[model samples]
Target: MFDSIKLRKQHGYQAIRDIRTATVKAPFRGFPRLDGEKCDLSCLACTAVCPTGAIATEPLRIDLGRCTFCGECERGCGTGAIQFSSAHSLASTDRNDLIIQSGQTPESFRETAIQSRREIHRLFGRSLKLRQVSAAGCNGCEMELNAANNVNFDMGRFGIEFVASPRHADGIVITGPISRNMAPALKDAYLSISEPRIVVAVGTCAISGGIFADSAQLDRSFLDEVPVDLYIPGCPPHPLTIIGGLLDFRRHK
Candidate 1:
């Protein structure tokens, strides 16, 4: 028991108290920085190498919604025209706002990406329960979301939790590209939830289909059919980003 206590003491405070100021480790790409003037107009190497069509030249733009947070665009560029920053707060209320143009930084993106939702705060401010639906996710986003509720993140302290059923949920969080096979089930789950519910799309797949956007098997038309309140962009968003996005959306000033 003494040895266990010693180990616990050595671990110190596991949960992060302030997610906004927390720093992520190196090489964990979160946001892209694009410099249009530095790029060679004749070369389209960055776009060619990108598995997803997240990169585009002609003034250079990267859509975080479709980005997998992969560093291929950075490695493909010879003139250092593209690189990634470690900023993880990439959630946005507007889908078009995820596009990063020249002269934009992740620091700047945060200002407008999240807007204060007074109506939503009034509904689920003190307590929020969510139902997670994985349509056809590769499980990468699912794993990171699971980490958000672990002891290290301790999201429960804020009265946020994932419930077992949609009937008990205050909102729905979706992961994956919404394949045709899973569309009906996903819709049924959404309809099962009580009224005044919101929808949160997590990961590049859920937000914009990531690398699988072109896949013929997907039925993302469901997204057009229903309203989405939040869009969290990343190949697999960090736990801090997920927690911070939720807190920022519902927390009172």
Candidate 2:
């Protein structure tokens, strides 16, 4: 007992005290704030460099659901018109909310990001069990989702966790583009979960097929067939974004 106590004290508090208001440091790109006024109409440098067609010119906008947060758009643009901030709390239940326009702040994006459903709060505010489906993911998002349950994040403490089977889940968290081969399995998993179940799309690939949207092997029909309860955008969304998104989605107040 003394040895255990000594070890515990040595490590101190490892997890973030608060997920909602915590600040993420440099290198991890979160929100893309676009400056449309500075854009040179002739130059499509940002658009050209984007792998997923996530950038739009004329009235510049970025689709977060399609974005990999690759930093390519910011780096390739010579006009200093784009920047990716370290504000990782970007997640929304509405697909249109992910389409960020120029001059939009994280605060503004967050204000209407989630208009939580009363039924959702009633059913899952206190506890949420999710079955994760990788679909055809590269596993980057899967790894981060795993980290959300680790000692540092401790998502399970709030009663949000991933289960081994869809039979035990209240919802399904999907992490990849719905590939042709994985479509049936994905549908099966969602069906296995009881009613009042949600569908959460995590990462750019799952939400908009990432760079693989045009791929003939992908069958993203599942997204069209089912309504997604939440969309957490990133190539592989940060664990904070994942946990924070879920929390915000279930908050009634």
Candidate 3:
């Protein structure tokens, strides 16, 4: 007991008191900032090296939904036109908002990415129980989702939790790119949840299939079939991003 007490004192308040104001590590990649004017007319380097076809010239846009956050675009750009910032508050209700264009900053873009919904708050104001489905996920998003419940993040304190069964869940959180083999099961899980349920697409894969968008084995048609309440964009979204997104979803009404 004495040893346990000593350890407890060593790590006081492991969880973040306020996720909204907390800052992620400088090395972590959350959002991409584009600078189209910096590019030379002959250069198409960023687009050529992009694995997910997320980059497009003319106006210069980087789709956060398809980005793996690998920072490869930054490496490929010699003019420093594309850079990734450490801002982790990357969640959106609309898919189109995930596209980052030239002259946009993460801080500025975030202002319009999320919106207040009365129905969402009225349903899940106090407590929200979610069932996570990894439809052919690489386990990257799954790991981060698990970390949201750890001591450091402690998402449960805000009345959010991941339940074992879909029947007991208030909503479903979908990860991965949704493979052909897993599509049916994914639909079944959504059907299993009770009405007034919400759906959150987490990570780049779930949002826009990431690098696997064009894979023959993947099937992302499920998103089109059902309405998604939230889209959390990241290669593997940070725990803070996941937690903050969820809280904002339930709050701000």
The 0-to-1 C-alpha lDDT of every candidate, in the order given, reads: 0.89, 0.91, 0.89
On residues 46-158, what C-alpha lDDT tens digit does candidate 2 reach at each position?
A: 98999999999989999999988889999999888898989888899999999999999888888899889899999998999999999899999999999999989999999
Q: List, residue by residue over 106-221, the lDDT tens digit for candidate 3.
A: 77887888886987788788889999999999999999999999998999998999999999999999999999999999999999999989999999989888878879999888
Which has the greatest lDDT? 2
Model 3 residue runs over 4 Å out of place are none
In candidate 3, the residue pairs with backbone N, CA or C atoms under 3 Å apart (3 or more residues apart, or in different chains) clash, namely none
lDDT of 1 by residue, 80-124 (tens): 989898888888888898888987887888877888688889999
Candidate 2 to truth, TM: 0.95
> What's the lDDT of the predicted structure labeled candidate 3?
0.89
lDDT of 3 at 139: 93
Looking at candidate 1, the ten consecutive residues that score lowest on lDDT are: 244-253
